[model samples]
Target: MAKSDTDIPAGARRRLLALAQERGASLAGLSELLGRNPSYLQQFIRKGSPRKLEEGDRRTLARFFGVDEGELAEAREKSYGATPPLGAGWVEVPRLDIGASAGPGALPAGEGAFDAFRFSRRWLAEHGLEGARLSAITVEGDSMEPLLNDGDEILVDCTERPFRDGIHVVRLGESLMVKRVASAGGGRLSLLSQNLAYPPVSVDVADVDIIGRVVWKGGRI
Candidate 1:
């Protein structure tokens, strides 16, 4: 018998569990990435607690998996190779093998190339983003919590240079880092953390290289 709409999400939940495993991530990791308690996804999956995800959470999961948002509910592979098509406005941006830290210090640059991430061109334009100057990087540590959590993948607009006050990826010496950047009135910049326990870092603008502004972020959830 076909499942009723009210019962559809159980199968979806089961599929999501499998998807997480295929991605080599855990329920706890997905929950934390969505800014939910560690057991949030566990409860939802094991108990069918929510039945359906909130709209925002659904969108997040879709973006993270690089799939159509509706697929999460469909919870099955495309039939007869008849996959849903994306709109013509959709575009993809490259993701580099780079990381930006929300805490202290950073990751050394590695081989910087990967398949690009797909997004709607209209959505990018809405956010003042240009695909040519954009790339995705991972965020490490929890210092940017309540904003950008650890393991979050953020999109950076390399063309959005000549930095102003906002979140940005910056390079100092051999390392690249992510922090809130604000002008210091003397051709200097201050890197601040969302976590109060971490102190602000000051640096001369000329002494460091501003990689790009953090335009967007997505994590598994």
Candidate 2:
């Protein structure tokens, strides 16, 4: 007989619940978003029916929540166990589970780091990023094509600073995105995209939440 959901570890369920609460999303809505019946997640969480989430479903949830797939229990147990210690002269930088949309928008979710990358201390100092809080996130759309491609991982400097003309991650309302930001004068700003197909949008500086500046990017060639 298959194990009941309640009989299995609850890490993934707890994490999902916390994310749902943080985003003010109902489980039924999230289930529908997953293309499942309204009671799918409700039953999975509350009634403990499906002992484990399907891999495809788990991947979708990971993308939607901006978290690593490993954070979702099964994968966590199979692969994302304890991380080894870092080598000398290397510093660990968290790779956030979030994705900064390069297209329309991606809802912000999970603020925790699901994985990390090691950087050379000297290289960090050379880039003037020493002691600066940094995070790595994946780009989710093709809006910033040529410069930033879909699935590209970017390093962001999270230190607070006055707005400057550069590629930065900004939160507009409930969505998080990465775009070329420039001053539009009169306390307004322009969110530009590299892809001409997508036109720019203008908004008040005060209305946007500047998460951080994109310092570097790496992706498949």
* Candidate with maximal TM-score: 2
Clashes of 1: 0
lDDT of each: 0.72, 0.80
Q: What tens-digit string does per-residue lDDT give for candidate 2 at 72-176? A: 764333321122336768877877777899999998565557779898988888999877777788999999999999999998887767768999998887688
Give the per-residue lDDT digits (tens) of candidate 1, residues 34-129: 899999888787767776575467668878877765566533211111212246787666566667778777855463455567788788778776
Query: How much is the lDDT of residue 56 in candidate 1?
Result: 63
Cα lDDT of candidate 2 equals: 0.80
TM-score for candidate 1: 0.57
The C-alpha TM-scores of every prediction are: 0.57, 0.61
